[model samples]
Target: MELGACPKSMRYGPCGGVRTGGGCEVVDEPCPFVGRPLVEWAGTELAPRAIELPRFLVDHRPTGDDRVDRQVLDDYAASGVAVLLGDHLDDPPAVDRVAAAERTVDAGVPTIATITGRDRSTDERAEMIDGLLAAGVAAVLCVTGDHPSARFTAHPDVTFVSEGTLLAGEVRSRGGRVAVAESPAAEPTRQRAARLVEKQRAGADIAVLNHSGPVADVIAFAEQASALGCRLPMYAPVPVMTDLASMAALEQFPGLTIADDAVNAMHTSSDPFSTGLDLAVAMAGELLGSGSIAGVNLSGVATSGGAVERGRVMRRVVDAVTA
Candidate 1:
């Protein structure tokens, strides 16, 4: 497939959002990178390794409301887990990421900020990374974000100047820690591990695996990546949905697949809140006990006004895993 055929124009080929049947997430065609040879990293030297992340990493989104966002940060600080801050597709408005990171750092929480190559030029992304690091974030997650939907019609003609691989190098060049993502369940599953190897060569210090099908899938992906010479510390995502609203929000995430049994448990149980929390703890324990992954990321979202409750659920999972 031609590079020009890809909507994201990614030098790294297929991203994590490729549909189950090998279709592009942005268009109704097969992914250009599908059935193509794995793209090898052209660079010679790898980025210097950064500091190792904590055992428990939780996803967080600042709602652009100071009071609500501060309460979330304080919860994470007290829970003793690192917070990975990024843009949620359904966020109210774009928060000042640098300011959020500063607040998180001030609250004594380890912070990892995400920089996406979506609607932002290369120079603009560079500025974001510098600002995040300056605000004392522990690392930067470089990603080729999901293509903008109709809600983002304002920038209909936005250009993607850098994909995750290029942005990983940018983060390392500035002496910032770099984390990259891979989808083990996306199309070209056999090549997903190789793709992560290429990202590692491009200077990624860590790999955060997307929500694949099950814990077994994550373990298999980790094994393949390790065999293909990927040595970065890897974190697997565990969905944390305590209610239908949270579950619905997570289901909207592109390319993420929660296990069928877990989903059914949440949908059919009389009390979804308790059922969801229990399922999360079980899944996290299984992933960590597999010994294939370095850690587990509590990955999900909350309804409006449900952030604190969701954080409490995540904290319970952390405690169970540590206990």
Candidate 2:
């Protein structure tokens, strides 16, 4: 199968959203790149360059109100946590990511802005990166975003003109720090690390590992990537599930797999919020102590109108881990 067969048009072949049965995430067909050899990076070789960023990172969902967003940035800044400002399919239509990043940076918070190939052309992405860097973002996370699910109403018809591997080099050429994502539990698991190596060669400075399974699995993935000559510092995601709503929201993310034990514990607990918070803290601590990863990303969905509450939960986990 060729790259044209992929709905995302990713030269990197299978993306993180490949189904367990080796099916495409967007179409009713087997993933074309499933059994093929990993596509080697074809871009000019560029060494990964380090950038200063916080050890504790949280996914910030803009509430679409400037005052609320400012207060949230101030809160995270005070807590010594960096905020990842990215465009997700579920983000409110009014949420302007560049403006949000500008506000976060202006507020003296470390901001990692994300750029995806899902809905923008190469020139559009380049311009976006330039705007983000000018706004003083600490780094730019280059990702191949998930295919738009049919459940999203009025989803735009767009093309993925440049995937993360290609975007990494683009970011580097524009003098911006580059962070790329890897899914260890996705199909072609063994090739995942090799893919990271290619990403690093394409100028990725950091790797953010998606929620795969247990902490042990995360560590193993890091080790595998290291053995394959991937030297980029890695950040492991710690799921922030404080309630059933948040848990359900997180489960909607493609290629994410929370351990069954943790899920059961959260479901059976008398106080799910406390149970989930404790579980997140424990997981963060374990990942930090594993000596495999450089940091942890407090990653999950917030219930409707629960962004502030979710931030409090993230703060608690950060405090517990750093204390």
Candidate 3:
């Protein structure tokens, strides 16, 4: 059987190239398979996050089902895109983030683990960093993760610097790439923009624009960043809604921007999932055309379609859009 050109190597397979110092021997491109997925993020990626077993998954799926995880990672990795693993939402961070990342690596998929900083401390950051280093992961996407418990909320009176910033600095010292999330949906105030630049200087190697809304807004955010001189490899997540019901539900969730165009298009379609997929593909094309972001993530929210189907559909969209 014949095979297509491998994007990672940009060469003919059966993938005989030896990666020296973690780069392709032929093209000198970074080894797409080694290290954490985010560090190896090219211009596009399929980011599948790990979430706590929701009430939805509790009855339908078993806890700790690594098979689905491995299969999902493998499918995306084969397409020359890195797999980003997300942190579960729990007090004290219930599951081991490093172990979750290790699963991605084990599937031969590069991955980025989400590191939450709110309601946390520096010492805890040190421990998590140690675990990531031990897990052989190379990149991370750190965020001031939402705080329902307020256990680690950063109060203004306390002069709370984000854990993501500290982790970025530490990751830099270790020679691994670090990513910090950016809120492009918010009005780009000088204060917020300046903080992002400072984050880059402090050791953040890249940016993941928080879940975006309209494509115009996303494009505008990129332009705003350019104007602000925030030059970092960046990616924006493509929000997926499997149905109008799901779309309506997300209205209360700030920053999960659903473009007006997308809503109109999806509302008219008999097949909302397919409509959503098309909208995502179109959004990806525009985002890449802007030449601002290095990639796009499929926010990994539960779609009306099952998680596996949503991811698979997004992988197809990434291939078509990025190609």
Error of 2 at 80 (Å): 0.3
Candidate 3 or 1, higher lDDT? 1
Stretches of candidate 2 exceeding 4 Å from the true structure? 1-3, 150-154, 302-305
Worst 10 residues of 2 by lDDT: 149-158
lDDT of candidate 3 over 25-125, digit per residue (tens)? 32335434333222111222222223211010000111255676556666666665665566534313334667776776676655666776544466776
- Per-model TM-score on C-alpha atoms: 0.94, 0.96, 0.69
For model 2, how does the per-residue alpha-carbon lDDT over 216-272 read when each residue is reduced to its tens digit? 999999999999899899999888888888888777766778888889998899988
- Most TM-score-accurate candidate: 2
lDDT of each: 0.82, 0.84, 0.54
Q: List where candidate 1 sits over 4 angstroms from the true fold.
A: 150-157, 302-305
Clashes of each: 0, 0, 7
Q: Candidate 3: where are CA atoms >4 Å away?
A: 1-63, 90-94, 119-121, 149-162, 187-191, 245-250
Q: Sorted by lDDT, highest first, which candidate order results?
A: 2, 1, 3
Q: Name the lDDT value of residue 146 in candidate 1.
A: 78
Candidate 1 lDDT over 5-84, as tens digits, reads 88888887787788878888777788898888898888765954856567889998777878887887888888889989
Q: Candidate 2, TM-score vs. the true structure?
A: 0.96
Relative to the unseen true structure, what is the C-alpha lDDT of residue 323 in candidate 3, on a scale of 0 to 100?
66
